[model samples]
Target: MSAPQYLVILGMLVNVSFALAAHGTARTGRNNARDNLVAVAALAACLWWGGFFG
Candidate 1:
């Protein structure tokens, strides 16, 4: 894969990691709006990056 593709893949991995972390926290009954927001932002960023650079 090219550099941009690698970056997009990395961004996707990061988004997934964030989602897993958020899920774990939620399972613990933690009110982590910030984490959820960050995960959403990461997903949006991944989408934008993929659209622009993929």
Candidate 2:
């Protein structure tokens, strides 16, 4: 894949890892919205960069 595709892939990985971390932390009563927001933002960026508009 090209650079942009690779970046999107990386972003997906980031979102997944962050979500897992957030879930784990939630189980310990240490989770927060900010963590989930960051993942959402990354997913948005990835989708935008992936050309959802096109």
Candidate 3:
């Protein structure tokens, strides 16, 4: 209900969305090293920001 909780929720949503997108890409054979790197970066960002804000 507060800002930190909101940040945590938002981070979770972002991570889930990224995971789904990465999975879809892999299924379609369109996934590449760069895509994987980007996904990893996004996940790291989500964790860092979420922890910091929370």
* TM-score leader: 2
* Candidate 1 lDDT (Cα, 0 to 1): 0.66
RMSD of each: 5.3, 5.1, 5.6
- Over 1-54, each residue of candidate 2 has an lDDT whose tens digit, in order, gives 477767766776786677667764646477665677676777778777878534
Compared to the true structure, candidate 2 yields what TM-score? 0.45
Q: Tell me which residue pairs clash in candidate 2.
A: none
Q: Model 3 reaches what TM-score against the true structure?
A: 0.44
Please report, as a residue range, the 10-residue window in candidate 2 with the lowest summed lDDT: 24-33
Model 3 lDDT at residue 47:
67
Model 1, 1-54: lDDT tens digits are 478767766776676666667654556476565675676677768766768644
lDDT of each: 0.66, 0.68, 0.64
Output the lDDT of residue 43, model 2.
72
Best model per lDDT: 2
Q: Which segments of model 1 are wrong by more than 4 Å?
A: 24-54
Candidate 3, 1-54: lDDT as tens digits:
578767766776676666666654555466454555576577668867777534
Better of 1 and 2 by TM-score: 2
